[model samples]
Target: MERWARELTARLPALAPDRYAVARPPAALAHRAGHAWEQLVLPAQAAARGARAILCPANLAPLASRRTVVVLHDVAPLREPGWYSDLYVRWQRAVLPRIAARARLVVTPSAFSRDEVVELLGVPADRVAVVPGGVDERFTPAAAAGPARAALGLTERPYVLTVASRTARKNLGVLDLAARRLAARGVDLVAAGGDRPQFRTEADTAGILTLGHVDDALLPGLYAGAAAFVLPSLYEGFGLTALEALAAGVPVVAGARGALPEVCGDAAQLVDPTDPEAVAAALERALDDPAPWRAAGPSQAAPLTWDATARAMDALLAEIVA
Candidate 1:
């Protein structure tokens, strides 16, 4: 969400300097003060400035603000209530639908998420716009993976990677059998994300090396050094991590469900996240012969740029604020 906001608002103001201005919460209060600021302070400030429209890019928005164009990044809490705590899910169930219905227009990251919004939240399809997320320019095929490998202490063994949090919908269990299978081949399954307090869950990380919350600067190197990147997520709004892996010239094994197939295109090997055996087999193939996937990845990722996403957002802004 921070990435999307930073990339978006960075480009948005340039697109409409005369009309667009950014209002940031105190750096200390960013994540800590979202709800209260979003509901009460945001709309009040906008109205005071007489802003024509407000682009709430990170899902949550002021429910009463009719001029709000809220971006709903998948409607996951409504779809997967079991993944979150009772308090979190209850609040999501209450606020998300109301925000979707009340906003002037809704923005989503993919056609799959747009459909989910329409089907699950009863949002009109026409009201939701598809603005696919992008990869950073720095993520490209590395000439030498040794430095990155040594930096991450991954020089000892080749590893298959998954950049997902320890959440149920991430389908980390899909790695249970695969990790064991790969370990037998002198390979490792390395996971690089952590859990949230609102997440009422625990995953068995047996046979997998869990590196909680890898630094963002190390991500490009992490993706580049992997023998293969796996995204066994049952669902994704935009599959941004897989796209990054592709951009870094790594073979990707992603779930066939959600927006992954479309986001990955023909660059990645798609398999069922539920069927552990199939996902494992696909990962093995990708690890063994990464040449084809490596060749195909950059081209597939090249067109999905932050500039393009921002341009699309600019077009939408033109519509709403005109």
Candidate 2:
């Protein structure tokens, strides 16, 4: 979400200096307080700025605002029961439907998510736009792997990588079986990303090497060095890391479900996320024959840039204000 907000807002303003402005809450007031600010303070601030239309980059938008364009990535939180905190589930249940009904436009990252919005939120098809996230230029085939490999103590070893928070919906445990299966072959299944407060999943991580939270600077090297990248996420609005891996010229094996297949197109080896054996087989295929995937990566990722996302967003913003 932060990437979505930061990347789009970073580019949108430069397009029309006088037209776009961003409103932010203090960094300290991050989660709940930030939500409060967006509900109570942001609308008034938008009014003060004489904003014609406010773009709420994240899922939620202030109901008080008359003209609002909201970007709802997915409805996974609302779909699954007992996965998230009761407070969060209730809040989403109440707010998302309202946003769907009221917001002038609701942007999503993929056609799969657009369909989810139309079905789950009951929003009309015309109001939803698919503006997928982009891979930064830094992630490339030539990125130096030594520093990142040494940092993570992964030097001289082949590893399959996945970057995701240990949330229930991420299906983090699915890869543990695959990790153990691959261990015999001298390949490690490594995971980056830390835990979040909103989730309560007790996913056992006995097989995978958990790197608490990797530095952003090391990500490119990490992706470029990996033998293959796998995301066993049950639902993904947009598989950014998978795309990043593709951009970095690594083979990808992602969960066949959700937006991953759409994002990966034919570049990645997609398998059933729930079946560990299937995931393992796909990873082996990727590791064994990486040439095709490596060759296909850049071409697949070339068109999905931040500039393209911003251009699509610019069109949407223009439509809303005009």
Candidate 3:
């Protein structure tokens, strides 16, 4: 969310400097209350700036404002309430409807999420706009793969890579089972993201190496280095990491679920995320013949740009203000 805010705001000056301004809560207030700060302080700050409509890039918006544009990534809490804490679910249930009801326009990262919002949150379809996220130009096939492989202690062995926060919704269990099957074929599984103690312990039994929180600089190289990049997530708002892998000219193997198929298009080998055998077979196919996917990936990711997203948002804002 911070990245989206920074990039979109940075591009706004070139798009229409006089029309838009970035509004943020005070540092002290932000540190003290976090989301509470956004709810309590941001709306007034935006109003004081002579803003006609406030654009809240992050999901939650101040309930007090009717002329606000809120970007809702997904209605995941409502769809899969089991994945979140009780308090978190309660908070989202309370605030999301209010934001959806009041906001002048609601922006989402994908059509899948827009539908989810309309169906799950009872928001009108016309009020929701799909504005997918973009992959950074830095994620290119030109990045040296060797350094990243060595940094992650992967040596020269070929590995299937998946980048995700360790969570049940990410469907790491399927990856774990797939890894066990792939081990016999001499292919290792490398997972890059934060560690969840529960999921981390399970990876060892399958011989999957977990690199907790890869540095931003190394991520492009990591994507470039993989034999194939996989995302077996059960649900995703936009599947940005799959887009990143496509941008890196890597062969992708992802689940057909959520926004992954839309993001990956024909560039990836789509599989049933719930079935380990299907994921394993897809990984094997990708690793065996990566040429076709590698050639197709960059083109798939080329049209997704932050500039385009910003322009779309700029036009939406203009319409809202007008």
Candidate 4:
């Protein structure tokens, strides 16, 4: 959403004169609202400005919006009940379909997710559009690794990198085993996330390096510099990081699960995330011949720009308003 917001503003500065605006409603109001974005202040602002349609980037939307377009990223919580919080699971089960039913058009990241929405919510297939994500301009093969590695104190070695939020469903255990196997083969692993301190501690960091909360700007460099980038996630609506790594000209190793394969295409070495040995083997393959796999990366993430997204959204809104 941050990328979307930034790109949209850059393309259409009129919509956002100051380029960015950070509005903080009162703490009391936030406390009362349950969800901060759906609170009285934001909804009132939307309504008062004659905003005909509301766009909820995520599956969940403010119930108060009369006309809405929602992007349902995935239906994973519904499929894997034990993977999320009780409240989150319940809310997803109950509220997501309601939002889809109410939304004029539902957008999803991949055809896999679109199929789930169509089957689960019974929304028409035509109503859901697939908009694959793109690599940011900051991501490129030329991105400076020296600054990023120096800042993170990374010692140069054949390193496999994985970037994730460390949720249970991400299958961090697979990565733990893969790291151990890689270490035995004279390779190191580096991981980065905002909420993965427990994973860092538990991964037995003897040969692994955990750069907790790496600077966001350095992410592109990190991806470009790695020997290989791997994602052991069990499920993903769309693996944006894998696509980003591929776009940066880095060979990818990802599980043949969910939308990872769809986004990666022939650009990645696919494996079962549940099998640690498979992940390790895939990582080794990518490391052995990273150059041959570079061409398989996305030809070009065309028409995935945020301006394209917002323009499509604007057209949809115009129809509803008219």
Candidate 5:
């Protein structure tokens, strides 16, 4: 959400400096009190600025502002209730409907999410727009893989990589099983993302190197160093990591579920995330002979750009405010 906001706001000034300005909450609001600040303080600030319309880039928006544009990434609370606590899900269930109802427009990262919002959240389809996520320009094929491998103390041995949060919905357990299978065949697995309590015990298992929360600056090289990038997730709003891997010229093996297939298109090898054997087989194919997939990756990723995404948002905002 922060990345989207930063990139979008950076481009907005170039597109329409006179019409749009980035409004940030005062530093007095602590990071822990972000929800209260969004719900209570943000709208008041915008009103004081005499803003015609406010664009809330993150999922949560002020329900009191009727002219606000809300970006609802997904209806995850309703779709995968088990992934979140009861209190959190209940809060989202209560407030999200009101936010959607009062907002002038709802923006989503993918068509899959737009449909999910319309169907699950009872939002009108006409009010939703699919802007799609974009890959950073830094994630290019030219990134040097050697420095990243050396920094991580990785050998020249081939490896499969996956970047995602260590959550149940990310299906890292299935990736672990596949990793164990691949380990016997002389291939290693590297999983990079923030650690979660639910996956702490699983992270200790051998044959899989869990580099918890790698720096964003090193990600392009990390992607380039991998023989293949895997995403064994049960669900995703827009599988942005898969696109990043493609942009880095890495072959991808992604789960067939959620928006992965839609985002990956024919660039990635799709597998059933729950099936460890299928995941292993796809990884094996990418490692054994990556020529075809490597050739296809950059071409597949070429069209997904932050500038394009920002332009679409700029157009939508213009239309709403006009």
Candidate 6:
């Protein structure tokens, strides 16, 4: 959402008729227990002072906004309640429907998510607008691939890549098992993201290189050099990383769960993220069938761009304020 905020602020300066302001509540508080109450109070107070409408990227927000638009990323917690802890699951079940009812409008990242929201939250279809995300032009086919390979010492063996945080829904445990199965066959698995300790212990480092983070300038080269990109996330609103990989001309293998299947469409190899064997088999197939997948790469992510996403958002802001 930072990317969206920055891009929007850049696209339409605050000096325009509608002032663009992005505020981050006390982060330390928001992550802690009882912090939502303490952290939200200020934004609730600020909502009245020229903050005509508030846009929430996540389902929960300060309930005291003047005119609100809540962007429900997914209905995962509501649909698959078991996937989350009891407190979190209970929180969403209690709060989301209330937000949906009270918000002036709702926004979601993909059509799949929109449908799920309607089904799970009982919001009408017209209430949700599907404003898909976009890719950075930096992650293009023309990006330098060899430099990242050399820097990471991956110049020799072919490596598959995935970029996901250490969240449970990212399904890194399944990828770990798949890497173990592929290791006996001498295939390399390189991942970028996850906690430092988790990557150290969980990832298959035999031929794997796990960097917690890299400079933005080097990220495109990393994407461009990969044999393929894998997104084994069990749930996603819109798999932006998958789109970035496709934009970088890297063939994608993502889980069919949530909006990932819709985002990847036919450009990716969809697998059951819970099945390690399936993930391993899909990885093997993606590694072997290079010609067909690579041929479909350039056009796969051609439709979405930040410029388009910004325009859609701009139009939404105009409508909301009008």
lDDT per residue, candidate 3, 18-89, as tens digits?
997777666676532867778777777877887899888878888988889999988888898877667777
Worst 10 residues of 6 by lDDT: 196-205
Question: For each candidate, what TM-score against the reference?
Answer: 0.95, 0.96, 0.93, 0.85, 0.94, 0.83
Give the range of the ten consecutive residues with the poorest summed lDDT in model 1. 25-34
Top TM-score: which candidate number?
2
How do the residues 1-322 of candidate 6 rate in per-residue lDDT, one tens digit apiece?
Answer: 5455556556654335455666555555535443465236646655557677776655566665537777777778777665667786777788888888778788888998899889988989998899988887898878997787777666556678888765567777787666776666666677776453211234333434567666557778888888888888888989888988888888788999989888788988899888878887888887778667776766878888877776787688778888
Computed on alpha carbons, the lDDT of every model, listed in order, comes to 0.87, 0.88, 0.85, 0.72, 0.85, 0.74
Per-residue C-alpha lDDT of model 2 across residues 1-322, encoded as one tens digit per residue: 7788888778898987777988889888988899899989998888888888989888889987758999998898777857788888888898899987889888999999999999988999998988888988999999999999989888587988999888888888878777887798898888988888877665757778889799999999999999999998888888898999999999998899899999999988888999989988888888889999999988899999888888889988887788
Q: Which RMSD values do the candidates have, in order? A: 1.6, 1.3, 2.5, 3.8, 2.0, 3.8
lDDT winner? 2
Query: CA shift at 136, candidate 6, in angstroms?
Result: 1.1
The deviation in Å at residue 77 for candidate 3 is 0.7
TM-score of 2: 0.96
Candidate 5, position 19, lDDT: 82
Residue pairs in collision within model 2: none
Comparing 1 with 6 on lDDT, the higher-scoring candidate is: 1
Measured with C-alpha atoms, the lDDT of residue 101 in candidate 2 is: 85
Model 4 Cα displacement at 59 (Å)? 2.6
Per-residue lDDT tens digits of candidate 4, residues 1-322?
Answer: 4454345445434443433222334656532263655634556777776666666665666666656767787888787777776776776788787878877778887898999889888889988988655566677777888888888888887688888765676776677677887888777898877553222223333445767777788898898888888888888888888877887778888889999988887778889898978887888788777777776664544334555655655555556667
